[model samples]
Target: MPASAPLPKSARRPRPATDYDVVIIGAGSAGLSAALVLGRCLRRVLVCDGGAPRNEPSPAVWGFFTRDGVQPSELLRLGLEQLAAYPSVEVCSLRATEITASDQCFTIVADTEASRTRSITARKVLLATGVEDELPPLDGMREFWGHGVLHCPYCHGWEVRDRALAVYGRGKGVTGLALLVSRWSKNVVVCTDGPGGLTNKARQRLQKQGIAVREEPIERLEGTEKQGLQHVLFKNGDKLVREALFVHPHQHQHTNLAEQLGCRLNSKGAVWTDKKQQTSVPGLYAAGDTTAGMQQAILAAAEGSLAAIMINEKITKEECV
Candidate 1:
């Protein structure tokens, strides 16, 4: 971002010895986008490339405008490359382990790849840490992750369209999920692993929609990585060859920083923020999957950009005062 007109020396606040203007945890789409914006505004920024993103195992990211079908790693590489233009921004592979707040600034303790610990301080903090998916505990589930088993139909549905697909879940949510998956494939089955916990009308609706319900308990999934998932074995000794499976797994924050800092969380456990993305804690902000139920790369990036701009504005007002 182009810098605004320089403030008069009388009105300007001298730079303190604080390590950075902002310390951003988790350099995913959100952190990277925030760093880009803050760097352009000439604010010192540090983005921690903690580890692989939540979608690291995903083959490709979809529905992102102008970058559809791009590999997840490739998109991150491009983001990092473009951020190189901003001298005020720094990206490091550090795992932030602890955080504490004081009157002067917030302190952060991070561990390097070599396991060396480093302490840093910043005037502001942004938590871009995403969420973690709890995959169902079933044999071959890990092996077929991102390939045979998936989430987010808009993200991976087109690839498996017209193929034999199964929706894994039970109760109310599974009913709607199965109906949604039916849009991509004609052969859709709901594997409830026992009683489906559906109302009579709900089951009738599913049947009318041409979606089948499997009440047999699942034994395990059988598949090869090279050819993708081939079969789902049931405890009743019946087996069905399913090309792909979809499930909306339970999710939780990838890191506990938000809770550690006393940021109020919403009912879904995501850090609650105002429209400007500032968390309940002053000078602290959250963006991306850390702040909302809806998860998407493009949406996370937009949140990051908005947070950065809001942070800059807040800092400017402080300086003027």
Candidate 2:
């Protein structure tokens, strides 16, 4: 019989299952930073992101070294472009569905439109999945978030400097926020939103700083779509006009991915990680708002770099073993 051409395999080794030395979840500041480090080390790294960043609402992300006033989307785009230069790094524009540990490695399941579901095996996992902001139930509050009704003074304070500002504080942190906002605005009001836990000392401190302390419960927010916040409506049918409103949203972790992987969490429900960004679960690390309450992009990036170094070291040790 004539020799026939060799037959190609029906399924090619499935692209080696896209295995990696490190798998990072969430491609925000933290995950991208980690990818940059691991990729430089020539380690196979995959970053899975859902493309929904926590700071998407904010127009600009400040406090970064040189990219100050850069929009959040633009910053992420630049970061992704930088990471693309590394041949060892791959960015998957998808959401991580499930993660499980088995036989000294982590199995990550990601969902992609064309691929349906793809699995990756990794020696280490970094969780930079950030958090979600739970704004109070006030009318017009959500509509104007990031525009005029805002959070994080350092992030948005400079834009609204010297404007009439009001802070809605129903908790202990209100006093501190009021003081912080006062630095940017000469006219600041601390609205206690119905007096839940304001101490006499706290009230006096606010007054001493020329901050008006309002004990009325806010009913709703009044504003125009074009101009953002205009006034704070009270339960007693009173309205206090203001140019901007500062609020402290109840922040919550975006996913239970960390806790599900047996990582320890603090009393405040934040992921617990050491200075090296290693979590309670060995071979697993967490950074950014999910791990720390600081909630700043710069802090998240720093933590991610730390985690990357620690993870790389652990991987090296394992390879030697």
lDDT of 2 by residue, 43-132 (tens): 999999877799898888998999998999999999999998899999988788888886578888888968699888988899999988
TM-score: which candidate is best?
A: 1
The residue-by-residue lDDT of candidate 1 on 242-290, one tens digit each, is 9999988888899898888899988878899999999999989999989
Model 1 residue 112 CA deviation in Å: 1.1
Show where candidate 2 strays beyond 4 Å. Answer: 1-18
TM-score of each: 0.92, 0.91
The CA lDDT of each predicted structure is 0.89, 0.86
Model 2: ten consecutive residues of lowest lDDT: 9-18
